[model samples]
Target: MKKIFIGMAILSAGLFTSCSDFLTEEPKQEQSNELTFATFDGVNKAAAAMYGMFQSDAWYDGEFTLMSELRCGNAKNPTSVPGSGRYRSDTQWIYSDRSTSPLWSYAYYTIARANNVINNLDDKVGVDATQQQVNNVKAEALFIRALCYFDLVITYCQPYNYNATEDDKMGVPLVLVTENGKPARDSKENVYNQIVADLLQAESIMADDYVRAGVTDKAATPTKPAIQALLSRVYLYMNKWQEAADYATKVINNKKYELAPADAYAAMFSAATAPEGGEIIFEVYGSDKNEYWDNSGWAHLPYITTTDDKGSHGDVCATKDLYDLYSEGDIRKSMYKQHGNDYFPTKYSGKPKDSDPKYTNVPILRLSEMYLNRAEAIINGASIQGVTAESDLRKIATVRGASQTAAATKQGVFDERRRELAFEGHIAADYARCNKSMTRKDFDDSKNKDVAFPSYMWALPIPNRECTANPNVAQNPGY
Candidate 1:
């Protein structure tokens, strides 16, 4: 299907929130469900509500992305002179409940909405709607649901390869319905399989034959490339290197997206509107005054609020090690501005106010990821179809100016990924998928050290609120 970008329209519909042990879907208002599935416009409005979950303080627009890098040692909090322990727990992986980490409930909250749409859409139809239209609506919900589960599993479960046979291990429960059922954790293997099933079905239903005749929003909707791109990441996590490479190759060969050139790379982030075609396959849009994290917005994150801030109140700085990864002439290197010990990247500086939303169009998938995924997969023993791992690495590195003298290697792929994806999330999961341990021993700040592989800390504890409410819900071991 030729993909069309249906820009995400914000809805006034009330969103669902979970209060039970396991996730239970409830509409934001009474009769909301009845109206939601009553007409096609209503179902789409529900879809917009799912996007609201994406705009939340805990999920993509904020902490979920922050947690990925913070716990992985890409960011830090100031050394409190005393009393004020701002980001201590986060940087130390000290999160426990939904209070500190809102991702748990919000993820399930998103999944619940998706289930509501998928299960109920059949009974409700818009005027003059075709089966294809209905199927498209359901496919979008499935994609969102699959995305939520993918995020939840990676956040709350240990690395997939933690056990040679991980089918018996626990992940967050696979809640496929909206009812208030108190379910125990499903195996990580099972959750992964479910994600695959959802993504494949989603792919099957999208209008593959629909060709884009006009412009479209890059992140507003899921596309075949987006589904394929996500499957690449999912397979990478599963250690299915061949599958990862294959899916990545599929995206790269589709000819739908061209990587933003080095000069254009920084501009892509700064576009007042979602920019014209580039490498982005999927993203979420939020502004300073609207759908932002805190009043400060997504840009308010990335750095601590500071009076002397250039673009952002620099809270989160790039680790010195991350800052040092860039070589001269690498356009990617210039993205960060080092202010003393703190470095702020201008990628999120779309609206440069002290507290305004950075106008960050949150990137969920990009062409660069596909190249990186393909390279890493090939290096890890996947068969090379059209290009070698090194060739793909050079494709990215050369464009970024990092390959002027840099040679392609397994480590080179890691370096490019870490640099290319910095602050856009994917840091910890990168380590997890590789079965590598993350440590903060190099951090200049006080306290915590290694977040070792195969540990309970790897899986965030099931929220205390849920456990307290539902006897069937089990807390993560050692939390």
Candidate 2:
């Protein structure tokens, strides 16, 4: 039954660019030769596939700019592969023809999935069975779509395109329809408006009850918490600090999720029970038999282990800066182990007891992050208070073994975020907020051995495909 669901789910969800004039047609199965998405299960399965894209090689497998491009900080080493190492130019303060790079396709591929879900969902059938269920499903789809758009805008377009006369700022293609036809880019401000609209509607629709956070039941969908969490993150990126603080506070005060204990910190990254950890508000589970290990294998493992395990791609190591960041008594240092001069990040450490290698589910949102974000937002946007903001956030991380204290300043909050959320894809965003830059020496500990922030890398260049195919699309200045 699970296999059937996985298979139908992949077929029903769209994950490629729609750049031709192909007409929309219902997905047909070989056995029945009939459209298969009229049922609720069919639609649900399709949505699962779209959510699954977050874990694929396109985004998390070290291919996505989240780690590869030197847009944020230095990589641990110059030991990067072909498609992933283009950001080295940024370290040298050079920008060339990266506008035509291949990484852009990942953005479009994700957008295609969002388009498929938005296009195929029909209210007529869904409303007949359960209006609430239908709305919940639609809300989940919209949230996913919004996430894709948000990623594209931050990655490809300039930061808010603040000065452009509406027409000059190139936004991503807003392909709301599933038809295979190219669409021109929207303005940056226009794209922001759409993103805000999607999140607002999604929160309203998801206000009711639903299941998320590792619940694999066919009926499960994103709930209000997930929507709110993403909203807080979006607002933070947009510099809407008050709004970000409000949403972050909302989730923090809800009192539903709690941070794991100090002992459970290691378990939070353990493959065995990570999905069950109360902190994980959204995550993707993986199985050895399936292709969806969330790229934990590719992102965390190093090439040529001391044991000489050639199983995983020979890449990814924790830099000495990250290693030295841990204090002498901090228990968090256990999360990584030294295999010599190089330290291997243990967030996805292989399983114990000689079983098949396993990695924890990729965590998308967690309550601990909410605490840090609320603290940052409060300090950035509102009046500074010790107990309410700084003390409150520090209390949690302290109990959870984070060695840092909360300070109500940009540097303090920034450092807290870096140490606490390290490698969870939050540091790159921080670079944008502080407007900092980094160097190749930072990338490999052998050179800089210290961390520096590069502000320009915060807004990633729009994927190469959009600029090449759409004449209206513009590339980021330095790329």
Candidate 3:
């Protein structure tokens, strides 16, 4: 998955100066995809390039994800000393800066790449054995596009429940074509509709027998399971409880993955390779050797890198709130490392003394989430036999070496999710959709963290650059 620009050819032309009969090669730049998607092998490489976009600093590796964790309140800037300016705005909850929302441009950039591959697939005349190639490639690209748009909208727009009359709220621009267009902000419903449509269309076209290639260590590439898994997440955000549960079940029931047992849990965190355990439903690979942009491991990295091992460590510390949630001897609590008084997550770092590249894979979705999603849905209203909120609670508790909670309640589910998915990027979002505020206004004792709505403080503002350049763009209220 790390092979940069694996096989998407760069088309160029040169004249033969010593020609017996003058010959000039036709330009290929105009028909780049003609050769790029000429066969299954070519299209496969193009798909890899599409997936590679996640490695950029804007998406998984850096700001796009880092900002999400900052607001979770589980991890805060060091207490005694103010840290690096890298994500200063984020930790302080001042999303007024343009850089805080890097996903805005990078996501659209990736979408354009996906469109290039997807738009070209339809006109492949009568090529040999290219139908399956086209189908597989198109499905993957559509999944890529949907994945980006989902991340973008969630960052830029208010939560689905932000406005009772949801039709009036604006979402990030829904760009679908390769050619640039002066697009205006669309309604939230329309943006979500496009996301759902892309994912469903992707699911329908994917080969039933399709097994994602290019990685054996983890689920690096998108497949039917990944697509279904994300649909579950998108539905959850949309507040479609039943649909979320159903789609989650589709991924959970598939025999391809399983949860990493309690005994192997420690190894799962500091895994030298992309993990092979059942828990990793989907992930993005990073380098222990090269610090590529969007390396996927750095989202949890500390602000400073002055440790014994060159690990990105100790800049951000887990909050007392998150630590208190773990009673005792819970495997999930041990995921964080303590430094004097501050505690930081070790899931993305190496052991304190041991030296390694510190590059870790980012788990985009996991089996545990399926159970949680279903449990929440059932607890809310939708009922599914053979599983209850309590059952799901016990399932995760057993794996984490924690006492099994017999009764399920709204708060119980929220607490369990915080314990299970902390620092993995859901902390803030879970609170937002539930209309909950940060556990403490200022974890670092700074008086600036405010979680009030009309402020759009929780929801990021449209980047200043975009608002300036695009006339049709409308900034969020507070900004």
Which candidate ranks first by lDDT, i.e. highest? 1
Tell me how far the alpha carbon of residue 23 in candidate 2 is from the true structure, in angstroms, after superposition. 30
Give one digit per residue, the lDDT tens place, for model 2 in 55-97. Answer: 4544543345335323345234334322233233433333344
Candidate numbers sorted by lDDT from highest down: 1, 3, 2
Give the alpha-carbon lDDT of every model. Answer: 0.68, 0.54, 0.66
Clashing pairs in 3: 61-294, 258-278
Q: For residue 270, what is the lDDT in candidate 3?
A: 56
Instruction: Give residue 347's error in model 3 in angstroms.
Output: 0.8
Candidate 3 stretches with Cα past 4 Å from truth are 1-34, 37-40, 80-85, 97-99, 164-168, 216-218, 272-274, 288-308, 311-313, 350-357, 404-407
Counted clashes in each candidate structure? 11, 18, 2
When superposed on Cα atoms, how far off is each prediction in RMSD?
6.6, 7.1, 7.3
Off by over 4 Å in 1: 1-12, 15-31, 78-85, 97-100, 123-127, 164-168, 209-216, 288-312, 352-357, 404-409
Candidate with better TM-score, 2 vs 3: 3
